[model samples]
Target: MLENEFVTFSQNFLDRSGNHRSNQKKINEYLCKNSAQYLIYWRGKVPVVSDVRDQLCWVGRDHPLVLNYSGMPTFLGLENDIPFFSINISSWLPGNYNEAAAGAFFDSNIYNHPDLPESSFFAELRGFMNRISAREAELAVMTRGINVWQENNLYCSKCGNLTEIINAGWQRNCVNCGAFHFPRTDPVVIMLVTHGNNILLGRSHGWPDKMYSCLAGFMEPGESIEAAVQREVLEETSILVKNVRYLTSQPWPFPSSLMIGCVAEALSKKVLIDPKEIENALWVSREEMLEAFSGNNERIYPARVGSIAHFMIKKWLSGSIE
Candidate 1:
């Protein structure tokens, strides 16, 4: 995939992450010196925008800010001279000065209001991702994922005991059963399954009408990425896929997920739509896909740019998926 070259923290959580000690010290110096770092806080899937940091403060959701990193400050070890971890706050920018300020900061539905700078935060971030050093974006993604995972997994799954942040917020220790839990990355298979010159795609019920992308689903307990691709295709659209091949992946931190993109050859073209999982499914031909990409196809739309689905499909159109 052409987008494979983008910098991502695929190895950030690996065993050798300890090598980042020196790097953390440096990043910490920068963050602490600044008035406040750009923080991404979420209320469910919607992110709360801090329109003005001048009047903003973070109150820990329950407890005061701690260095544990589990609730938000779990030290993410170190990265050179920078120390990066997560931070959690109950709410953000409590008193609103202007409703227009909301959309100017973050483009979220809950925080969306008119009168603010009219710029979508996600769009701005996407522009930054496309231009800035990939390392910066990678760091931002990693930081958000770490913070979200720690905030949600506060208790032990087995014994229902409260878990404490450990290993610099990378691991959680169960007080009752001595269980150590690590940050989790749920694997999702996103595949562009093709038959001849047509690619199979589907959309869920709540998605915008005619907005279809690659078929995707969570990996089963013991399923491999390739199996997930085939299984998801069959289950959702009854399209049997063969010759599955890996392409690339992206860390989607909307609650911590790793989207694994792949390309698969379709063995059967029959579409037995599974209404429970998808609102619609179809096989769009190469010409039609090109038209969709160019915004000329009115019946279907391509996946949003910057997404793994878009990356994979673009690769195919460029003859790189081979």
Candidate 2:
């Protein structure tokens, strides 16, 4: 990949003002500022213009939606000194809400708030992630990741006591035990395992038909990135790899994960299936991968656009995986 190129959610677009996170006075000042922008989220979905899904629907601090929400908004970061925050209004229910659709792998349903503009609808970030700019993607993912963490970790793990948001939503403090907890990000190793002219690809059991990407697994405790890459590949595909090297990284916040991308040279090519680990695994030649990317392959669909897998594969195909 080019030096300046970055995958979705990987760009440094916002100055996360860590210094001001602990300052209650500063945070309150930003919240009261008329120019402060807020991104409203509902059940992990953000509002975007239906006609053109290029930008997030940002509202001022005094917007009815903000005024109606009683919960505190999490401070995201600063963009050119303009404070950005995210508020969750998941309590509000829409007339056309489909619970099943909202919980799907990719929610296709669009929900419009009665108080908001007709063109603005809450949509899954993955649905229009590629359509928005890098800065917007970063903001959306940060908001979603933080909100998900807060919702799931309402109680302290150490003491099982209710926790309260502190440090401008950056940390949580236990009301009873006084233990402080921070947002957690699990590390995962996603590797492009190659044997000569072929690259390794695998698909999970319930992935869309023909949609395959690089082999990946969560990194184990006390394991290094290189060691995790080898162990995961061996366990999942029965393939041994050597010369493991790090590539780029992406912050994948589906539920808070840091995808550590790598390139490895396969030492053995024999195929061995692990049904529980993955539905199927295969080695695709460069020619076939190119054809798949161009939509000419009959049995293969490349990774989703704007994903690190897609970025890594494209880089490899262009002979840029250095």
Candidate 3:
């Protein structure tokens, strides 16, 4: 698949040296030797810039502000021969300001590091993922996902005790009960279903006006991916699907979700919108979707540009789907 067709957070240029994750002595050595570059993450946003229009710049090894980190940086693997690390700062980092009413956590923490260049400011991961290079996007995606996990998993679930960082910040140990817990990643299935020349698209209740995309849902326990696709499509749109096939997946790190993308051939086409699951469901013809993709249609739009739904729809339109 072309790199442009990938959903955000799917590209990784870093060589995740799993070899060092469990080796504390080596990590400490790297940290002490001043050979480590850093990615500063605070409440899920990172500093980014394009340098050129519609591009993203990678966080550098020699940025001056990296000198101020006192917190123990989390291991993010190595790029080239230099070790890369990430530091999680408070929600209000050095130059962050308070906002009156920000909707999500991302909006709550738009920061500007004091030492960064004027052209670079902290941006929410999603806002700039589309414009950045694969390496830049991967850094933000990996670090943001791990830090968000750390934030939510500060306490042990079983013993109701505080957990200590272990395994180089990847796992945590409960002090009171001596239980070990690792990071969490929820799995989701986002699928494209097609019948004849039309694709099944559904919109949630609060989605942008007239915007629709592939029907999706979480996979239940004891269910296979193909079964989940069949069940979710049937439940949401009353559309039966067969011949389900897996495509590429992406890490949607708003709170660490692995979106497994798929395509399924529809067995039945009668539309039955499940108000409980979706607001509206329709069969969008390929020609009509082509118009929407080209921005010729005013009332309806396909999925957002950086989403798996958009990728699948475009691939199908281009006759590239296998």
Candidate 4:
């Protein structure tokens, strides 16, 4: 489907991106034309969504601090064809803008910015991404990933000291030690394990009722993706898997995770569910899956539409994943 076409965010794209079409000359020319760049900010875990939660509100576009693009500020990468840049408001805007002085950034749920409109708040980035270039959306996701990584990794693992932003927010430098830290994306393996007429699906706690998805687990240190898939399925559902094959990957930015999609052959038919990892596990037949996809089956519900779990399962049912 068209929903999954531009969904795959590859590592090669991120590794080679950043200022792809912008040179000093082009950047300056664009800035001189009164076209401004904005940095969309999120507080705590909640993205600053609009009242309707439809679009992400932009700062410095026509706000209290009208930022000029010609003058340099920190870039947060281009998201949806719009260049995002963060300015040290204290350094750029001249006024009494300091509300809380506890290092300018905090990680808590506070009730401020009450007057801002939803249009100036959080955005369903996926929906807005359709209007922009692929590379721009990818960059925006990366910036958000970097922000999440920085928030979680404030305290260093090597030394119990706070880290400072360096490399233009790409890397962090620890003041206590000379260690440099980079962003981290945890790798998880999500597979549609199948044999003959059935495919394995499991549901975790806190999920919607009757909903199931491909089994997934983090790839542990020094473990391969194939081994991780087999191990996860076997551990959670007690189903032995063989001939595991890699299919595709998705950049799941719900706090920064890279999902590795796969298809594994089920070596055993019996299922022994691990209550700790799953609320329930089942092997549904092709006919049942078709019903689920068509929304006619009351026994099971497919995974959320935008997720790779849904994509993998749909592909499997259509005989396209074999």
Candidate 5:
């Protein structure tokens, strides 16, 4: 019973004008408009105004960064007649930047651009996902996901030839094989399994200590969502599950993944951890989970906010998920 709007990146506030993506003339017209604005990205990080509320920083087409940028801007969509676009300025690097820190699991370093406002700095989406509005979160995730896909998939998989951007950054055409490729979104299932009064949680290897969340696994080809949920739970914790029901979903664009949230009834409670799959597995009662969520439990850390796991766990704690 989790509400859709509360989920980050789940809002549909912008109009994704798909029909106009292939229209070069229309795209050019929109680009030239005064109301058009562009979101800037560098090395997978987005620029945001560092304030009490982290707002997405948008610059005009005539800005120094945009003018100096070398590639075509990807048309995101229209927000109330105002066209929005995204462009990667990854080629521009800040002085004394640490590549390792920027690529860390939780990067807190902020990179400021000399040409942009002093209040604006580049930040990771996961760091401030819960601080921004749902609309801005959606936009930022969309821009980041698309840019990452474009960067990593520049070459054609069909023939190993270079591909050119098309359909306003939504599609790529292979120059040699004439094949079309679209952005790839891998589906993953994160489920909450329950038996009697306890819920299942597991922590993967290399995760921060004491941090545990719902068991999750990537869905393989030719597999149903429910089947994936059951198989993953069984494989990781040796727990048999039944009555697999979907609750919600979140667009986890850490590298383009759609998290399918589900609730399953556990037939057994004994946990046998699979070392290759996860570091540890445990069952926590409802009271212990509530304590963990409130930060009162010292031995357990709940899922991070702005994630579907956290949302589903909260719903289950409130007796909303059957």
Candidate 6:
């Protein structure tokens, strides 16, 4: 396990200017006066280097990769005096240019950050999560999730009228019906279920070959964290969990999910995986998990280093989880 490692979005370096979100006049004045930069997320394909390391590379507002916007860009709060903004471009930008990074992750548009000219400076942020600094990763995650919400909730949920960005880029307001909306973060419980020296690991159907990690599920309404942890394990793996406690959390913004990490004790060892929920589920000895972490295990590999699953298991292996 890597030492001194911070979860991707847990860094506190960026000072999100909360006061300026409501003060439109002041924010507008700052935007007009200060030399600000943008975190330009085109569709969700964040910019990164083409190297195997896949370093993060956030393009500036004036970069050739960015085209002129048609209207007010979704303004992300400020970091110091430097203002941050994001904009969504039309699909036409990728239709004319033909290099393929379009749509970033979910679509082919990632290939088209206004057309990344087959160079090392531009690539999609698919594998760059571990390669980049935690600070930048946090910024990218925040920038992407907010914009995706804005896109999905363009119209007010209450009324059909289009909503306008109200609290900076954090929220939207419907002029037609006076309704307000904000970016949402869905809570997910990711727990390391342990019994003696072994930890529970489950793999989803489409994961890479031999990859496994902790059991997790979305937190349903009215469910306490402990109850969700216990219920998720029982439903998916047929393992009852007890002594649930918070360990850590990671912002899993593949759209927007807050992965609340926890540690739980298993009451029943007999494994019966719901094939519909998990492809395979079993208990992995801590020694085997350690081996998997170090690339010595042939049967399975550890979770990606930046993920909450990796952090929790690594902490448990290092005797840090209590």
lDDT of each: 0.64, 0.90, 0.77, 0.65, 0.91, 0.75
Tell me the RMSD of model 6 versus the true structure: 3.5
CA lDDT, candidate 4, residue 95: 40
Measured against the true structure, the TM-scores of the candidates, in listed sequence, are 0.74, 0.97, 0.89, 0.74, 0.98, 0.87
Query: Per-residue lDDT for 51-133 in model 1, tens only?
Result: 42112122222323333233434444434533444454434443443345333423333333232223322123332334434
Assess candidate 3 and give its lDDT: 0.77
RMSD of 5: 1.1
Clashing pairs in 4: 48-121, 48-122, 49-121, 49-122, 50-118, 50-121, 50-122, 51-118, 57-120
Candidate closer to the true structure by TM-score (higher is better), 1 or 6: 6
Residue 140 of model 6: what lDDT? 76
- The reply for model 5, stretches above 4 Å from the true place, is 51-53
**Candidate 5: TM-score?**
0.98
Q: What does the lDDT come to for candidate 1?
A: 0.64
What residue runs in model 4 are displaced by over 4 Å at the alpha carbon? 1-36, 44-62, 65-74, 78-82, 86-120, 123-140
Instruction: Order the candidates by lDDT, highest first.
Output: 5, 2, 3, 6, 4, 1
Q: Residues 1-322, candidate 2, lDDT per residue (tens digit)?
A: 2452668888887999999999989999999888899999889888997667888888998889889878778999888789999998888998889999877677888899987778898998888999998889989999999999998899999989999999988899999999989999999999999988899999999798999999999998999999999999999999999999988898988889999999999998987979999999999999999999999999899999988999999999999873
Q: Looking at candidate 5, what is the lDDT of residue 125?
A: 83
Worst 10 residues of 4 by lDDT: 102-111
- Could you give candidate 5's per-residue lDDT for residues 1-322 as a string of tens digits? 4677788888878999999999989999998998899999788888889665369888998998878877889999999899999998888877868889876777778888999899988887888899988889988999999999999999999999999999889999999999999999999999999998899999999788899999999999999999999999989999899999888899998889999999999988889989999999999999999999999998799999999999988988999886
Error of 5 at 321 (Å): 0.9
Candidate 3 collision pairs: none
Displacement of the residue 215 alpha carbon in candidate 1, Å: 0.3
Task: Answer with 2 or 3, whichever has the higher TM-score.
Answer: 2
Model 4 deviation from the true structure expressed as Cα RMSD, one decimal place: 6.8
Please, what are the lDDT tens digits per residue for candidate 3 over residues 1-322?
A: 3344366778778888877888989988767655677777766677665444244333454565455665567888887778878877654545336554244423634455666666766766666667776777787788888888888888999989998887777888899999989888888898888888988899998676899988889889999989999999989988888999988788888778888888899988898978999999988888999999999987588887777888888999998774
> C-alpha displacement of 131 in model 1, angstroms?
6.2
